[model samples]
Target: AISRWPNRVDQRELRQSEIYKQGMQTRRRVLGDTHVNAAEVQKSSFDAPFQELITEAAWGHVWSRHNWTLRERSIVTIALLAALGHLDEVAMHVRAARNTGATREDISEALLHTAIYAGVPAANSAIKVVKNVFAQLDASGE
Candidate 1:
């Protein structure tokens, strides 16, 4: 259970919110249960609030929008993360891209576009990370 309104609603009621339910479903769909479980497992008291915030805000309010397909959102996120040198998130998103129906070629194209605006060096690093993620995925037969 989680509480978006920790001060107002109890944890059970918070989890019952349409926003929270939709967010958890979307998060599990886009990110996968394994990754979500890992994060939930590792959550500490200090970071639990932050985790809930992202799950509700980022996944619920923003990601749940019907304006764009999940594939489109994943592509945009990959480009932004690569451009910003958020290599860790880049890797995570790259791995999750498949769940969103993003092919490796799509990710490559996104990174290539990022190079034009985000710089060749950033794209270069992201390319390396992408290759590694693909290799891991391939090995896992995912």
Candidate 2:
């Protein structure tokens, strides 16, 4: 499995290379160019390398995997992040859900499922956040 892409990833290859470029194209398409651009822009003199490393390792590496559907990954992410009370991360993933083919209903269920392991309070908060996002997306016809 690891042999698929090779040991090191070259972000530049995301432009010219087919497989690497395909993965990055998926990332940008799902996450939105603005969010991706903003993240890249924030990479300062010190944080630049670290930012590339994580994006390459996490977004480019793990998320780039073809084994799981983005929908499956998004649902799990929302639930786990909600349970941990990481609302910020939850919102980010919520935004990501659009790309994963995961609907609001899926997100709602994921948060509801979290109620079992996490407390009701966390689930409730996640619901509110998801609701707000739903409204926003609805307004934009997204």
Best by lDDT: 1
- Count of clashing residue pairs in every prediction: 0, 0
**Tens digit per residue, CA lDDT, model 2, 5-107:** 6777865455434444555666686688888788877868788667656556666767778899888878988998888889888888898888789988898
lDDT of 1 at 128: 97
Candidate 1 total steric clashes: 0
Colliding pairs, model 1: none
Question: How high is each candidate's TM-score?
Answer: 0.88, 0.76
lDDT per model, in order?
0.91, 0.79
Poorest stretch of ten by lDDT in candidate 2: 11-20
lDDT of 1 at 82: 97
